[model samples]
Target: MGSQSARNIEVLNQNIAELNGDINVSFEFFPPTSEAMENTLWQSIDHLKKLKPKFVSVTYGANSGTRDRTHGVIKDIKERTGLIAAPHLTCIDASKDELKQIALDYWNSGIKHIVALRGDIPEGGDRPHMYAADLVELLKSQASFDVSVAAYPEVHPEAKTAQADLLALKAKMDAGADRAITQFFFDIESYLRFRDRCAAIGIDQEVVPGILPVSNYKTLVKFSKLCNVKVPNWMHKMYEGTDDDPTTRNLIGASIAMDMVKVLGEEGVKDFHFYTLNRSELSYAICHTLGIRP
Candidate 1:
């Protein structure tokens, strides 16, 4: 038993040593609606910034008020941190001219990166759609912005077929997207297969894996269903009976995220994007374990 324990420690040390200083990370935040939430968001930012992420992005919402809030958050992030702050722009309910003007405004404000997406289709509101590819084209035409688009490893929920989804991603890249950040995924093999397919289809751009460290299992399940992401049964089993124990749940969450990062790093994936739900403790712990330090 003593020899086995010593061997486990040695193996763990080797893994940590291999991962140290070999990975790059980025974070995503959403616009906060209330003062308390705003404080929490900034606090999270302050904590994560120590790791020196490649960039930070604020997610865009569907309404005009949410759009304005996104811009505000972007501007504040830039002003406060002097970091590369990207705003997510979805071509869902706006005119081409309006999007063009918004792109121009962002460029003039010293913002250089944009996460372009085709946002969710509004309920019972069928409008002429401008796809993410269209938005990427519009942004590139308006300014020399570094555009990032979304990718799905398990396929998009609204996609007609997996092939069609791959073609859609290819179209976004063909439209001048610099890279693609995948939807948060749990199955490493699924993401690996998706990368192989992207390479096969001539998507030469880097598809950064998006990692959402599970904090609340219930919330993750609800969102996963909407996004058509399959949460593996083992994950459900791990979180079972931990609903009343946030401390235990957080520990499990960090361990799971750490395991995923270790595997991805071993697979030669250098860049990772973390979906930080405006809280930092779990992500901070995971990054620390990955040897990302202040």
Candidate 2:
């Protein structure tokens, strides 16, 4: 009887630890391409805004017009929801002067945070900024904005070696990036090991884990290939029979993300960044399960 009581107490402790609300979360969204997508984006934002994410970011695509559209959405998020809006700035085809102008424009428009990235190079385009470190430097030169840069637990697809990838991340941090948001990864140890390596290298800035809830396995697999993120075999096995069931897939996705949060929280990872893809339900459910309340 005493042993049974002790076991119940231990279980209660574990539950409390999981629901302690020590976690902070931010979300990411892409700029809408059409008016219908635009409306959907806002609706998702409205649903998730009450959760009080630390900040929200809008991504920039390769096109020139997409930049302004990203800005408008970010501005609206900031003005309407009063949440900190971060605009992703990619230095791909633009010259240094042009990139600097864009940074200044964001600053002038009362937007203060930027996610500096060496974005995807357009088809047959040259590398103008060369690296994300360059973009980080350029953004810092323009203003004292809170800058975030990308990190990879799995080495970047273009990186020649693991050491080279870590060095690139160090360079961005050295260039005054305030935080590093890692690319979404399924292997939990990938993040834990990356954090250890960053600590070993003395990159002391905040390293936030990026969590992505799988909405569609097929789409996720395609994106994982493009982003160099690996989907583990066990995960594939879990989603094997959910191809035709969106509801079951979402439940599975939320369960996967919640497990990650519980493990990561126990490991002392205090913050998370969600790649929302402008969809709310899965992300919202993950946060809700994490004890992140409205």
Q: What is the lDDT of residue 262 in candidate 1?
A: 75
Q: Estimate each model's TM-score.
A: 0.95, 0.93
34-103 in candidate 2: lDDT tens per residue? 9998888999999999998889999988778998899889889989999989998888768888888888
Worst 10 residues of 1 by lDDT: 8-17
lDDT, residue 160, model 2: 92
Work out candidate 2's RMSD over C-alphas. Answer: 2.9
RMSD of model 1, in Å?
Answer: 2.1
Clashing pairs in 1: none
**Decoy 2 TM-score against native:** 0.93
lDDT of 1 by residue, 1-294 (tens): 699987865666577668788888899999998999999999999999999989999997787789999999999999999889999998897889899888989999999999999898888878547899999999999888999999999999989999999999999999999999999999999999999999999999999999999989999999999998999999999999998999999989988898888778767788999999999998888888888899
Worst 10 residues of 2 by lDDT: 8-17
CA RMSD of all predictions:
2.1, 2.9
Say which candidate scores most in TM-score: 1
